[model samples]
Structures are given as structure tokens and as C-alpha cells.
Target: MGWNDMQPLLVQATQETLWMVGLAALATVLLGLPLGLLLALTRRGGLLANAPVNKLVGTVVNVGRSLPFVILIVAIIPFTRWVTGTTLGWQAATVPLAVGAIPFFARLVETAVADVDGGLIEAVQAMGGGAWTVVRKALLPEALPALISALTTTVIALIGYSAMAGTVGGGGLGTLAINYGYMRFETTFMWVIAAELVVLVTLVQLVGEGLARSLDHKRPAAASRWTFRRSVPTQTSAAPEAAETAAQETELTGSALR
Candidate 1:
């Protein structure tokens, strides 16, 4: 087929991919954020430490993560149909996409939250802050960079999952590629679709990296300066004790001489 012949199909496929990815991302964030936080905060010695709960949640997350996407899609068909009222469209695709993604995203979020400094959490607690306050003001802020990176990974993974959705007539770029490139043996069409996927993945990575860098407060230059500033007061306070000691010695010597 000519380029013109493929243009409309490409547009439709792109739209379908975007719709699937966007909705899945939104759902993942909503469902995963709390689960991730819970996982991080309920581990042994964590804010809401509970070994049994943590173990259960961890097992479930691991199980979800371990399942193959194809199997997951098939396994969740009935639930997808119930939730979406159809198991064969972009909307239907989102059901499995979101379900599969939530646990994955939650684990990423847990890792990000765990990377937060323990001292920050302790500081918040010392200030009489509650769990939610500590999470909001300390954990999330401190781990913003890691969390942003995690979010990027989640989005990229969702794109891959959306491609798999094509098997069920989800009709994204994957479907277009399969229909023309595989079924019709149109090599050029396949290449075009492949190139688009690469570009999309690249763009997602670049944007995610940019956001991560922007959020990172641990850059050496700024961090070193901040550390120095924090230490200066302690150094200055010690100076007064040294000065007092010297003055007392001088006074004793003068009295002895008199």
C-alpha cells in the first residue's frame, strides 16, 4: 500500500494507542499510589509496621507482576467485560492494562518512597507530625525525583501493554502493523509502525529523565552547599565555649601575677 493509503489507518491506530495509554496511566496512578505508600509504610519497622499485612500485599504485588501480559489479558476477560461491558475495544483494553499496571506501578512507587531518607521521616515525627503528614511533607517531597522516574517507567510499560491489547481488536498501532505488515506482507508499513513506536518510547524516556533531573535535590553541588550551611551554626556555637575557656585562663593568670 502507498503512504497515502496507510495514513488514515495510522491516524486511527495512533488515536487508539493514545486513548488506551492515557486512561491506563490515570488509573494506575490513582490505584497504585496508595498501594505503594502502604507497602512502603507498613513493612517491618516502617511507619505503620505490620508484618502480616506487608507480606500479604507484597505477595499479591509479586503475583501480579509475575503474570505474563497475554495471560493476564485472557485471565481478566470476564472482569473486563463486566467493568467495561465489552471485551473487545480500547476501553476493554484499559481494564487489563490498568489491573496489570497498578501492581507494577505500586511496586515502583514503594521503591521510590523507600528511597526517602529515614532521618527526614524521624524529623517529621519529632515535630509531632502524624503518618499522613510525614508522608506528604517528608517522604513524598524527599523522594520526588525517584517517584517521577518511576512514573515514567509506568507510562512506558503501559504503552507496551497497549500494544498487546491489539490482539483483542483493541486496534492500536500494533493492530495496524499486524494487519498490513504481517498479514499482507507489507514490509514498509511494518517499518513505519516500528519507527513510530521507537519514537514514542524515546520521547517518554526523555521527558521522564528531564522531570527526574528537575526534581532531584541530591545534586552534589547544591547538596554540598546545603550541608555546609547546616553545619556552620554548630561550628560557630562551639567557638563561644572556646573563647570563654581562654578568657577564664587569662583571668586566672592575672590574679596569680597580682
Candidate 2:
């Protein structure tokens, strides 16, 4: 086929890929964030520390993560159809993408949240902060950097999953690549799709890295500023010390006057 003929096909494939990936990322974040928090908080010695719930959530995450993507795509077809009302197309593809991504994202989240300082949580508790407040003030903020990195990893992973979805007629760039490059022996078409996928992956990685860096509170400048500020006494503290010294001096002067 001529370049002119291939342009529209390529465009459609690209859009489909974007749709699959974008929707999957959204779903993964929404579902995975809570699941990850639950995993972190319910584990042994965690704030909420429920053995049974932790075990159950951990088991489910492990089992889901263990399954290969293609198998997962097939395994969840029934549920996908039930939830999405169809067994094929972009929407149907989301079901498996989400199902596959949730556990992966959750594990990442668990790691991120777990990396938060236990001391911070203790401080919050000492201040009478509840679980939600602790999570909001301590865990999430502390873990924001890792969580952003995890999101980047998750998006890249979803791109790979989108390719796999093509096998089931989900019709993305992967499907185009397979159909033209493999079946029809169109090397140019195949290369085009492959290059596109590479570029897409690269872009995702770059954006993810940038976001992770931006969200990271551990950067040298921020850390240095925190250290400097902490080393200095606050005005509130210095003011009281100054007032007490002045009061003592005044008392001495009064005694001398008498």
C-alpha cells in the first residue's frame, strides 16, 4: 500500500492505542491507590494492622501479578463482558487492563507508602491524628515521589499491555503491526508501528521521570532548606527567651533602685 493509503490506518491505530492506555491508567490509579493504602496500613505492625485483611489483599495482589498478561486477558473475558457489556473493542480491553494494572499499581503504592518514615506516623498519632489524617499528612506526602515513579512504571506497563490486547482484536497499533508486518509481510508497515511504539514508550518514560522528579521532596535544595531552617531557632522561641532576659535585667535594676 502507498504512504497515502497507510496514513489513515496508522492514525486510527494510534488513537486506539492512546484510548486503551489512557483509560487504563486512570482506572489503575483510582482502584490501585486505595488498595495500596489498605495493603500498607493493614500489614503486620501497620497502623490498622489486621492480619486477615492484609493476608487476603496480599494474596490477591500476588496471584494477580503472577498471571501472564495474555492469560489474564483471556481469563477475565467473562467478567469483562459482564462489566463492559461486550467481549471486544476498546471498552472491553479496559477491563483486563484495569484488572491487570490494579495489583501492579497497588504493589508499587505499597512500596511507596511503606517507604514513609514510621516516626512521622508516630508523631501524627501523638498529635491525636486519626488514620486518615496520618495518611493524608504523612504517608501520601512522604510517598509522593515514589508514587509518581510507580505511576510512570505503570503507564509504560500499560503500553505493553495495550500491544497484547491486539491479539484479541482490540485493534491498536499492535494489531496493525501484526496484521501488516507479520501476516502480510509488509516490513515497512511493521517498522513504522514498531517505531511508533518505541516513541510512545519513550515519551511515557520521560514524562514519568519528569513528574517523579518534580514530586520528589528529597531533592538537594529542598532537603538543604529544611536542614537550615531546622537548625535555626524560630522567632516564636527566640522572642520568649529575649523577653525573659529583659525581665531579669529589669528586676535587678529595681533592686538597685531600692
Q: How much is 193 displaced in model 1, in angstroms?
A: 0.4
TM-score of 2: 0.84
Model 2 pairs whose backbones collide: none
- The global Cα lDDT (0 to 1) of model 1 is 0.80
Clashing pairs in 1: none
The C-alpha stretches of model 1 lying farther than 4 A from their native spots are 220-258
- Write model 1 residue lDDT over 172-255, tens digit each, in one string: 887787778988999999999999998998677656655555456575533332433443344453255335533643453233
Angstrom error at residue 159, model 2:
0.3
The sequence of per-residue lDDT tens digits that candidate 2 reaches over residues 1-258 is 778978999999999889988999999999999999999999889999999999999999988888877888899889998998997877788889889888888987998898898999999999999999999999998898678877877887788788878878777887888788889999998898888998998677555554555555575643442432432333343344335534643453233222
Off by over 4 Å in 2: 222-258
